[model samples]
Target chain A: MTVHTQHINMTRTPLPILPISLGVLFLGTAITMPFWGQAYWLHEFVNISCFFIFAMMWNLLAGYGGMVSVGQQAFFGLGGYFVLAMGNLAGVSPFIGIPLAAILTAIMALPLSKLAFRLNGGYFAIGTWVIAEVVRLTVANISIVGGGSGTSLTAFRGVDRVFRQHMTYWIALTCVVATVALILLFLRSKQGLALQAIRDSEVAASSQGVDVIRMKLAVYVVAALGCGLAGALYFASNLRISPDAAFSVNWTAFAIFIVMIGGVGRIEGPIIGTFVFWLINHYLSDYGTWYLIGLGGLAIVMSLYMKDGLAGFIHRKTGKDFLSIKRIYRSK
Target chain B: MLLTVENAHKSYGALAVTKGMSFSVEEGETLGILGPNGAGKTTLFNLISGDVSLDSGIVHFNGQNITTLAPFQRCQSGIGRSYQVPHPFGNMTVFENLITAACFGGQMSEPEAYDVAEEVMNSMGLTSLANQQAGSMTLLNRKRLELARALATRPKLLLLDEIAGGLTEPEAQELVTELKKIKAKGTTMIWIEHVVHALLSIADRLMVVNFGEKLADGEPMSVMNDPEVKRVYMGIEA
Candidate 1:
């Protein structure tokens, strides 16, 4: 008699047809938006896309990499300045300068990681903030790029206002899609498994032959690249940049709020959180201080009740992940 | 010698954790290490595994000097170790944890890693808990997972640190049985344990360490009967 032993196969959630269909439909709408959408809607789309890109970057850094950085705006602001400098001084188109700015920001992150990694836990968060402030102060002193007062991006000077807005909107949408795709692809790779292992236990990860420092550095640089692209696209949309506005700590604060309200570690959390945040901002901005207070209260409640954020709560309840990269083992 | 440590010394400020300890092991031998609490048994394991750098000494593995290599580099070079505290990646599934070790430490390809991880889990009797999150496992199962993870690296030399430290008698016996199976496969191992019976059951040779120095070394039964070992380690009339 011949006997067969049981076998096990590990698989990620099979690609859901419903979500894919809806995603395709959404992409269709986004692509055709400029044809029928008003200028105001385009502006809103650009704003939402920029915040979403920034939130995704922060989520990848802190949620997955376990590096909670409060100074990510340093790269964001630097990207804005790079775009302005390239366009006005170096005669590069602002559109062309956006990607170059992101690449430069990634290179800068390599050295900054050397400094920031010296601190651990809460000290690391504060260290990054201090570095961001130093960048702001140093940029403020430079007479070029308009210093503290900032400068207008002149690369769009020959272009029509409508055409400029359309181009900026397309770039913002591309960035949002690219950010999601990049993070999804990364989390599915072997390096992604190593990264989560490090997050769980650095000593165990090292014992398993993972290069902890190198992985952390890679995540840091990738996050900086995303933030840089967001910042460049944001200023390009606005047509102007200032040291205070571009380098504002509020950027990181908003990103934290979005990631926290959505979910800390899950990919879907930020997308849902950004929409909720945008709704509150749109309806309640007129209330001024009360709006900020309401947002803070909501954040506290979400953190207390839904520790993993809204998406996490949904995931726990339903046990379904639309963008899960985790492998699921089944007996065969 | 498959592995050799020459005058390995490690000191933490005024506290000398490992003081000029020297030892060697053959290609397929199992060496049991015994010591009282705070006797630097774990420190010796750390030095050999490169988890902690030696203050001064040379460590050779497979006839290659590996004293300056990083912990991960040591793991890649086939030195696998289990922690006393059982540090499995808490959020990952047991299968995922094993696969991580297989892919990185064992340098196996994805499909090969999966196969090796499955085999290790089955051998460790951890197949049922494969999909469960590592942190949710009970202490005994967690220890099993720790051993399974180290084994997934396919190490030429396995360093088992206190694998039988905190188990009931029956649990320790079960672990010993599992360990004997590994030994029967001719995998070299250095086990540090407070449980004397479990250590003696499988160890061909034994070494006792105290005060950062070797107190005794020889065949397990003879070492246990040594008058000096009895006086210092067993605290009995010799």
Candidate 2:
């Protein structure tokens, strides 16, 4: 035993200096994009960031935590409405309101989880959608926020157009970076291990002393927080908020599509999928119904041919994870 | 006594699985349990470990009433259990599985858990399979991983449910040798097994249970020879 102990050790391989340096270089250039890049490109990036963050949250919930929630847009819609409420009612700047709106949305998830958690498997997915619809209908009846027709974010009315666009762009960039960094940290933590174990087998995890219910609830709330943050930032850029746009089921559909094509359990899945989704939307969106059909067909192909998605396929081919969180045993 | 179950009763509606069963285990004692297919043996283990809650009764662990504690809480309070059929976290490597049991069940920090996991893997002859995904392992290896995980918890009491149920004679003897090492360290154990010869080799005392009732409990040979035990468990006409 003593001899074996001397030779065996477990470790998380530290991030290589190469990726860190490359990441820093890319981020530095991106931070200065407003000075040299076109406004249209900035808008595109803001849109991509929103999709990436939202999809990442969905991946964390379903891919890692074994929770398949299709109603996350409830929090998204709530975030949109909350920011507008803060600006229209309390006169808070939309900039300040966006973060607060996200917090309020996270708090809302606690009670919502109580109801949603009562159902499991396919029922859970449907239950969340029902909850989202309930939230949307409830918000639509409130006249101050334009009811169902929605209203503009008037708080940004006085702010310079160029300045607002630049700040919004920067905020979106920040959200993407922060989301990636934080999720990476979480997946490497002990709680992250617990979450994955629960995902694999709740009974086994519980027998191993993991508080399965608590871990699931925590992941649910965190996912809601991510969705809310993305929603608020998204509408902040678009300068409008309405029940139909804010609570649209298409938001979740796009997120699910992105995660499925990219890879369900890998961090790179959402990032890669968002890029692919952006390319398709940018190039083929004008085709209308055909574009939607193409997406559905692509998702089917990906599921059938590449069960693990694009990132998983890439890993299988190259034997490398661009962003790995796996812990390995090392022999000294 | 290190553990005590008094009138433990559990049922699934009209079907009574454990009917007012009671027993106790002293510190460092290995109690071998013998029972027929539906004799509520596994159910008793569940009741003690808090996997299945008692319909009405009391469970005392280390002199503390723990009847209402959750399964995780029972584990935290120095109880460790292995399933009837091995239940490894399928996608995770064996080392990750052991680290989880040590970190959560034993309430150890990451570094401490890693060290314990390493030692357990080595002792269980699983160091070579540390990086192997648990679900991909053979049945015998899965059983070893299951026991290794339970040991990683550093439990004051270990509940093993048919750890050797499917092994060949040589394999069962190899496991007995491993279990003897654990016993030498004075850890209390309650092992449920149909491998009578294996049970006879290590169990300090033997117990026969039928329909959730204790038919006999005493020295190994005497308990095995009890007329009631033979008639019921061994299926010999009295």
Candidate 3:
């Protein structure tokens, strides 16, 4: 008689040294950009970082939570208005108002999700847009925040231009880092697992004892918080806020473009997609309408060929994930 | 009784799916439910698991009234179920699916859930395909994964809805073997199946439902020989 033993080795590998080292090298360059880089580069960094944060939030909400919202600008606009109101009226620093706006936006999201969650699929998308339009019109009539005419951020009026630019640049970097870290930590947690299950099938998730409604609501409010933070910081850097620009559907459009091109579900997709989007906008802005046309064409091609986005294509080819949450198992 | 359904009623606008049907199962007993198409077998499972709201009456599990509990709450309270059509989380691996059930439904911690998932996978003959994406699996594997995932919830009572519907004879026999092992471990079960031979092999008691009403209930062979059951299955007066 022969005896055989079967053994399975299931372990989570340690973080890859190469990617961590390369990531550190990139961070080193980014942190010192203000010292050696041109002012234009710093300004662009702030814009890219703001949009990156916004796109990340949208990706989490739509990709992970299965709540495809097209009206995230509702929170974005609200954040901008909140900061403007605080800076101009209450004499609070816009920097202080930025965080405060995020809180307020999250509180507002609680009620908004109730109404928005009632609709699913295409109707949900349209419903959110309608809500944003209502918000834009209401803000337009609020005369207190300059209404339709809009208002400029006055909290930074006394600060020097050099100091202001550096401060804004640092704030943008902080927000981007925080957003990525928070999401990475979240996606690695037990609750994050539950959220992904809910995304796949709400019925199956509930059968597994996940509090489906609670998980969805949490993701919705958290996404709103990130969006609000980005909106406040973006306008703070621009030093201007108007109902049209703040509440514009273009914000959501740009976010969708970035998420679609980079990959909707994966974390690294937004980072790669945002940079690609920024580069195209920078180089092709001179072409005016042709730039928009080219972007539209590229999006269509990407969707048809690479449904998972650029990051997904890269993953398929290289079998590497810069930000994967999937667990690995091995047998021996 | 481990599970008790008392005169539970349900309707979908013009259609009354469960017409005040009542039944109960003791702990560790396997109750086999045989029903014709659209005879409210699945609907009965849905009511017990809180997937559908009952128009009236109550459900008691482990001696507590669970009529008002949510689907998830029922799951947490030790009632687990498998769907007629598998509902595996397509993006997740088979192991992750079981982990979700263990962590949430079984109310275990992360490490504990992993242990439970591994055990369930091994017992269900799913250890070889643990890392496979559930959506890309064969129908047989999907069915096994569904049952494994539900079992990972550590339920006191398992409600299986047509788990044997689409399996080959050999595959069905293999499942029967696995299920018999689980029965030996003493988990209470209520299985609604079209496969009469498979149900007869393990069920201690047999029930027949027709037009949302209990047509017959007794021992497996006796229930099969019942004239009304013969009439219902034959669709003619016996």
Evaluated on the second chain alone, the candidates' TM-scores are 0.98, 0.98, 0.98
- For candidate 2, what TM-score does chain B get against the true chain B? 0.98
DockQ, Cα level, model 2 = 0.49
Lowest lDDT block of 10, candidate 1 chain B: B108-117
Instruction: Give me the runs in candidate 2 sitting further than 4 Å from their true place.
Output: A1-8
Output the worst ten-in-a-row residue range by lDDT, candidate 3 chain B. Answer: B109-118
Candidate 3 stretches greater than 4 Å from native = A1-9
**Candidate 3 lDDT over residue span B1-238, tens digit each:** 8988999999999999899999999999999999899999999999999989899999999989999999999999999999999999988888889888999999987677777788888889889998888999999999999899899999999999989988999999999998998889999999999998999999999999998999999899999989889988756677
* Stretches of candidate 1 exceeding 4 Å from the true structure: A1-8
Q: Model 3 clash pairs?
A: none
What value does the TM-score of chain B take for model 1?
A: 0.98
Question: Measured against the native two-chain assembly using Cα atoms, what DockQ does each of the candidate structures obtain, in the order listed?
Answer: 0.52, 0.49, 0.51
| Tens-digit lDDT string for candidate 2 (A1-332) | 12234334556656656766878998999999999999999988998898899999999999988999999899888887888889878899878887888899999999999999999999999999999999999999999889889999888877898898898899889889999999988988889889878877888888888988899999999999999998988888887889989998999999999999999988889988998999999999999999999999999999999988999999889978888776677644
Candidate 3 per-residue lDDT over residues A211-253, each given as its tens digit: 9988988998999999999998888889898999999998998
Better structure of 2 and 3 per TM-score: 3
Q: Local error of candidate 1 at B175, Å?
A: 1.2
In angstroms, how far off is A161's CA in candidate 1? 1.2
| lDDT of all predictions | 0.89, 0.90, 0.89
Q: How far does residue A135 in candidate 1 sit from its true spot (Å)?
A: 1.1
